[model samples]
Target: MQGFTIIEIMIGLAIGLLTLLAIYKLFATSEGRRRTTAAVSQAQTAGALALFAIERDIRSAGLGFAGMDPAYLGCAVQAYKRTGRDPAQYSFPLMPVQIVNGSELRVLTGSSTNMFIGARYSASASGVFTMERSNAGFQAGDVVVGTSDTDPGNCLLMEVTAGAGSDITGPGGVAEDDPTVRHLSSGYTSFYTGASVTPERNGGSSVDMLDGGATSLGEGWLFSLGNRPTRNVWRVQDNQLMRYNFLDETDTKSVGVAEDVLQMVAEYGFDKDGSGKIDKDNEWTGVDAELVASKLDRLMAVRVAILVRSSQYERDAVTSAAPKWANGSKDFVMGSGDDWPHYRYRVYESVIPLRNTIWGQQQ
Candidate 1:
């Protein structure tokens, strides 16, 4: 073979270098695409999980209160634990607790001390009390007294008989009997209020009315799926989604529950009848409890949209897209135009029945 010239050798080297560079670029492009697909999938999964959790809780909003007494519901009962008056003196402490105002559901569980300590003055109002008991063998109007003669702080004791005699004695007088007594347990107490009682912000009881002004209550009760107080608007700060109790005045900042929550949207489903449907006429407004009750089967659907913005991709590849519209653009947008910016949009929707409403009908 003839020896190759310097120019020929240089040309051959150039061709080889160009081919290698192209192969490297192809691999890099494939890797980038893989990562982008994974990011999108992850974001979708996260959004779906969040939406499901919210819907599950919302569906059970006002369950287990329709057949019970109004006082037990606590929505209609004004004061829960009496500090000065006698238990028998007043109407058996109409469920001594209520679900107050907050973004999430709140339930007031009385202190154990207040529930069983009988014959003692109703002075301290802060303690974990029992609200229901199936084994206590107590009726609807029986007083719950302290059975532990030694500790007096551990267990709740109930007087099986109602309106018999004053279990609590006062200054030269005996405590009266409460005709509306109800029992409760530790985990979750379902007071059998005949009518539904929605608590007001002022710590007073109101029937099917939500307090529009008040912000915080020591025992602010919000009824959701499992009778535990839950927050609605969770905050995402410092790359974390946190849970905040709007009723907790002390906890200005909430605790983090999830991370990387880019967006969340909530929609109220107005079931005009117990039959679930999205009737325009039966939507939730400031007035109309009947509509609320009849629509008690109302469903709350939460749509959580999240963006998985990671540092792995090149910023130049990102594009600004238009937002997707659901429930119409007019309901969510301001101004009479479509000049709004919508970027890479993903939505997840979850429907939950308001378990706390009489309309739910099904537990």
Candidate 2:
């Protein structure tokens, strides 16, 4: 067999190299497109899942607290528990949702209260109080809030204890220390076995105000948060949606729900003029100090927006601008040092009605 000419061989090699180059370029472009598509899809899914998880809690934010009168709405609930001080159990605004420092979202939710717990009651600074209805709900380890009849300046928070009432009496009887004081009791030694007294959060008394004295039928009411109270705080951390349970003292760690989550923004939709409807769009948005308690009662709905980013980084700028929600009323903010432009983003927005608030208003 004769060897091919050097020129022909060189030409063939050149053609082969060109073909290889063409294949490489095509493969690279296809891979880039595939990655971009995957990233965008992931972002959409992540945004959706994050919103679902967060809205679940936000929907039921004020379940137990919604039944309170307007006077008690803004009351800074004073609390005490034998266990370590949980922020939820301590002093806090009596609102389902409270936005702090502009970005952090605090969503408060308690277990469903019972008929026996909702009835009118009387409270004393001594922590002893009387309930008008059956004290069947009261139990050891139960967290209870006593709203004062005389004044709503503050609310008393105390945990039901397993300790016996007094030396010469039991619960529902005259206090041994002071024979005149008689607070309602669970009528049992313990509803929850490990119940005890908690130190006042502010080194104050068990109650915020004096005992109601109108034949012990005080306007004040007691709300017992049985074992299943939840105080959840939601925020975006490190491109991940993280949630921390303020009520739970055992696990201090935050649980991450969605990946590639960039930021979450929420707007408050309130009946500004008490029209029972949100007349104006974006009128009084956000849960600032003014949007809580009574104003929060006016909050008919909440508009939540979540911005999610893609896991894939692009060589070229995939996102031209930051995502916006609420008709550009709010936008995702990527602080310094973030390679935000090299990523893709998806904006998910939803207007969630505060059903409890809405239902409360109807009542």
Candidate 3:
């Protein structure tokens, strides 16, 4: 038998090593690509879910009784306590669309009303008054609005306490009736006998006509009162989108809506010209968020921006692309600074019009 030469044996071993190395490289490349695609998909899913939730709420911001205006939709009434004796006992006023320097968002929703009870059973300026409707749906601690029966345009908002025999009270919570405390007109009048009465809850209330009556309260467009999921706050904390509903008694704890949310920025759009339409060029983009907030009643649209990130780390040692947004005076970034290459990111944006605001404009 002829023995193999040393040169030939060495050549065969070298070729085998080269083939193995090529297979390993191919596998590595394929795995890296797979991981990248998954990360991108995750980011997209998270961003889409977050945007959808926000848009839904924004669109329904001022929805309430028929003909209710959006301008009156955003008022933060004290959150109701689930375990308390009275859920509406401790709520105070909070803005409907409250933004913490453009970082977080708070929204108020309106609860529907049962039919209007009859006119004031008896009238007195004292916070309490009588109604023709039974106390079946109406209860103590319910927020109700009283309007003029003759000029339904004249209205006063009050809380129900100690309901019995068609009697409802607690306007301004004053035992002794004060004519000066009237939100509609001094002294409760028989004119409210047939006025509309609607419930106000879930961060929604009828427009308190400070200058008296703006228009006649329409038929069936009256008072509303009830316990409902009418308000909540949305915010990004610890890379999670959390919702807090003070009005809900069952779940008082903050719940996470989505994950990997880095930041949220919103801009208010207005129909500054009173032309019944919102245009970007005429929007108030002031750096001071409070100024924009002051004009919330006039706001016609809202522009929201959300930043999302991948849940897993990418293997790349360096990356040339990163996400960015112009937030206020600073450039908002994702996976920015020294850790830019470790993750992937995306930005989701939407502009929602305020139906309530538009309705008010038309009136």
Candidate 4:
């Protein structure tokens, strides 16, 4: 047998090592590509979901049962007075106004246990308020109350009369002895009326207007526009999007609607002349006629751009092999900082009706 030379053996070994290295490289490249594709897919899916949720909510912002309307029952009482002072003489007619507080939104309409008020209610410490319910006794177009009332205390409890025709007396007297005048109670049924049988006072410590006074209108009143303890904020923290609803005084539910969102940016569009355009002079920054009209016409669509990051991108870093996939950039950058990298994402937006805001201009 011929013995192999050292040089030839060394050459053979070198060639074999080279071939192994080539194979390793090929596998590594393929794996990296797979990871990159997965990351991109995940980012897209998450981003799309986030954008969809936001758009849906924004589109329905002033719609559905919560839509902006004079009949929303979320209006604040522009003016109110006790119909009469006599016993069983508690009738307070209110002029309906926009929902000035956020907390009152949930209680505006009566629930299963409460009768509908047909008008909105508000709890504002500030003196400025809109007509919540028309003066109790006036017909449509009848001007009973002045433009606005300065005395915030003038707003008393609201009453739903048993019958119609405004036969109810002021809070100081019995229902105007008219047979048309009907007796009404806040309780759902006689079972809810207690031994005291005292009609609940609006400002009292525990005056229950609905559900047999077990719950008070003021309980949810603190969430009004001006009283919202904290402004609603949307931001990304720890790779997850967070929404904070800060109604400090009310028990309203706050929610974080989405996750994996890297960033969110918003722009307000203004339509001037009822003709949609970016008319700088009529931008939404001011409450001008054009701005107001645009808002009413849904000409002011909210543009929301959201960036979603990949959930599994960082896992490869823990492995011994170098990450094969290249980390890509994101479409949006949060704030003024450009240090962070955003992944694949989608942008979603919609226009909403500023029902009360626009109608106020006509008034």
Candidate with maximal lDDT:
2
All candidates: CA RMSD in angstroms? 13.0, 5.1, 9.9, 12.9
* Per-residue accuracy of model 4 over 87-198 as CA lDDT, tens digit each: 3222221211111111111111111211112233232222211224432221211111111122322223322222223344757886662222112334212212322232
For model 3, the superposed segments whose C-alpha errors exceed 4 Å read 3-7, 65-95, 113-226, 249-252, 280-282, 286-295, 315-336, 360-363
Q: List, residue by residue over 123-188, the lDDT tens digit for candidate 2.
A: 443445544544555555556666776667777655554322333455888545322222333342
Worst 10 residues of 1 by lDDT: 88-97
Candidate 1 stretches greater than 4 Å from native: 63-240, 245-253, 271-276, 281-321, 325-343, 356-363
The sequence of per-residue lDDT tens digits that candidate 3 reaches over residues 19-67 is 9999999998888888778877877888899989988887765443323
Q: Estimate each model's TM-score.
A: 0.48, 0.80, 0.64, 0.45
Best by TM-score: 2
Model 3: lDDT of residue 123: 35
Candidate 4 runs further than 4 Å off: 64-233, 244-258, 276-299, 311-363
Candidate 3 lDDT trough over 10 residues, lowest sum = 178-187
What local distance difference test score does each model get? 0.34, 0.66, 0.53, 0.35
Query: Which regions of candidate 2 are displaced past 4 Å?
Result: 84-89, 113-117, 123-126, 136-141, 161-219, 249-252, 292-294, 334-338
Write down the lDDT that model 3 would get: 0.53
The global Cα lDDT (0 to 1) of model 2 is: 0.66
